[model samples]
Target: MSLPDDTRYLKGGPVAKRIMAEVARDAAKATAEGFPPKLVSITVGDVEAVGVYVRNQRAKAEQAGIGFEERNFPADLTAAELEAAIHGMNADPRVTGIIIQRPVPRHIPIKAIQAAVHPLKDVEGMHPASIGNIVYNELDLAPCTAAASVELLKETGLDLKGLEVVVVGHSEIVGKPIAFLLMSEGATVTVCHHMTRSVAAHARRADALFVAVGKPRLIKADMVKPGAAVIDIGINTETGPDGKERIVGDVDTDSVKEVASWITPVPGGVGPITVSILLRNTMVALARQRALYQATYGTAE
Candidate 1:
């Protein structure tokens, strides 16, 4: 049976642009007072997709009036080099926030690199300290994409409290943190992984479902509960009939849209919001630092 065409799409790009513009205004005020906000992104290797993502992030940071720095390492660089890069950014006073793009070189140890970044500057929220803050429900900056997921839901005017939310995938960046954020918002969250027994069963019972397994078309129509809100965070590329590749998300959008009450389309949805959240985090960091500075000194002229 064909699913119902009752889906509500959440467009994130325009919302992100608007939010960043606000941040830019605030940043301008701070800079006029002699304190400038800055963000640095560290990337290893030259993976095409990762490069594109980082470039977009840098562009957004610049447009937001946040200082942007790019630190590039060779593909064959050792883990120690990556750690050094993080340490350098951590020590740089000009850098208010730092982000390390994922899918680092296979030979590099991500855990070690993540540990080297100072918790304050780890704007991507991948550090253990940041995760601990999340676990303890502290007022620390959350992982950007995870926070963006919550923002997307709220922007849709949906109430999250007491909802049955199911998240597929167990990645530290998107899956686990998002579950924590949803739970913190008072939603009953169930986290499923690649090996979960009957993952579809769990998904079918959700009031809201977020999928980020990085597999194209992983979440099918039947697996989604009727009227459930589905957020697809995966971006996978596959070769088309003409030998070119196209980007696709976890949900079978065409079919799932019929069943879901609300959904996020891949290209226009989560990607933009995630970048927006990163800028927001940078703004937050800058504001806090500015406040501390003002308290130490006197108000600017």
Candidate 2:
């Protein structure tokens, strides 16, 4: 299913393009009706990686016919101060979606900050209310990373009903949500974390494996069932042969690709799809915000 050069890649490029095209159409429609979708990214620190991610979202938003803005706050800013800023955005009629970048100052609680973003504008889907919706199979507003992983599995033509899925992380953001989403689709799910005894043992049983534990090369070929679909959601930086930096997933691609039926390359796989989903969520938020606006003003656009 792939060239020898790319290794049965479940590449996100094609999938993301298709999804973005739909987002663009909806975005255009929203704008034509006078409610242009707008996304706001809040960062409380100068994290380099977070900066790159925000910029990428900005570019993607522009391409999708959505308006985007980023607000950077000093690391020394108090939690209350940041929450106040979020409150301001929450009340803004033009802001359709809100995302709080991670790695905020240690004193600031991310959960509380994310909670401050109105659920209607929580485009990243990190708010407790937004994530809770997944329990009821409400995926339209599910977390972007988890949604991307599910989409990647679909590319393999794997039947979600009664399929075996192993997720090797337990974090609230990526791991837990992906497992819940898989279950909603009727996949039998197993979640393994740092505390999970013999992580490889659990992973070996999966018809589809999702790895997002952040450890590099944590899932190897020996741990994957033959012909299984593998989705590596981990992004790790490592130095390669020339001593330059390279990004890789949790799975050992060279080894896993030999045995797996389909695999996603770290940089080009789930990452693109996640960003696209964020934009798509923005469009959803746009519609929801428009409803609220219309109800308040007695005007339909």
Candidate 3:
């Protein structure tokens, strides 16, 4: 018989706080060097979801001793204007990271907009160059959300050489990078998406499972291997039996907790860790850009 204490809840609060402290130290060092790091977020419209995300990042930036700036543009702006603005940020050394929020006007091409961001300042890791770097196993600049899942798995101390890992989502931002990053660590990783037939069959045999598709409670108790670690990266809001609103993950926490060795909670799991990694990425941009400057010139300044 399984007990309530059989499973461990993996929370991101502690991990994120530790990372924030380290990022603050790095931010202080960069400030002392007269090149304080800053993150510039580009927002095209006033999407409610994007606003919430921007607020969370702003608070974290202040806590980490990094400066955060937001640039808002009208939806009617021309493509040429957007490209020129991105180019200016790329050339400006004060700008440490550039994040373009989504849900832009349909006239503007999202891919083209993301492409305009310089690879050095692409803190979100959506740039093609940043994504390509992971193929060669160069992980210093990997995607933040994907890196968070990897960081959590590292806590388990599972031998990576032959571990069986199943990822339930194949989205570009979170899933693909995770599969590649896991493979780089020698784990045999299988990626499944909406088109993957019998996804649960693949998930039930893994030493570790990562779920990031937007569906709520898609992975039930039967789909998880006993003692397998579960990482839930999905964030969904819905009405519960009580007729009140609730937030949940892709994994059914109530049922799956009884069987899994470790599981991440919906509201407190990957979100915080991912944000901290974003700040950490911002902190490193100074050193990375300084290296580029040195290679181009004789010094960082």
Identify the leading candidate in terms of TM-score.
3
Judge candidate 3 at residue 89 and give its lDDT: 97
Q: Once superposed on the true structure, which residue ranges of model 2 sit more than 4 Å away at CA?
A: 1-7, 45-49, 293-301
- Score each candidate by Cα lDDT: 0.83, 0.89, 0.89
User: Estimated TM-score per prediction?
Assistant: 0.88, 0.93, 0.95
Estimate, for each residue in 94-178, the C-alpha lDDT of model 1 and write its tens digit: 8898877778888988788877878777777778988888888763478887887777777767788899999999899789998
Residues 45-132, candidate 3: write the lDDT tens digits.
Answer: 6557699889999999988888999999987988789999999999998899998888888888999999899989989888999999
Span of ten consecutive residues with least summed lDDT in model 1: 1-10
Q: What overall lDDT, based on C-alpha atoms, would model 3 receive against the true structure?
A: 0.89
Over all chains combined, what TM-score does candidate 2 have? 0.93
| Better-scoring candidate (TM-score), 2 or 3 | 3
- Steric clashes per prediction: 0, 0, 0
Q: How accurate is candidate 2 locally (lDDT)?
A: 0.89
lDDT for model 1: 0.83
In model 3, how large is the Cα lDDT of residue 36? 90
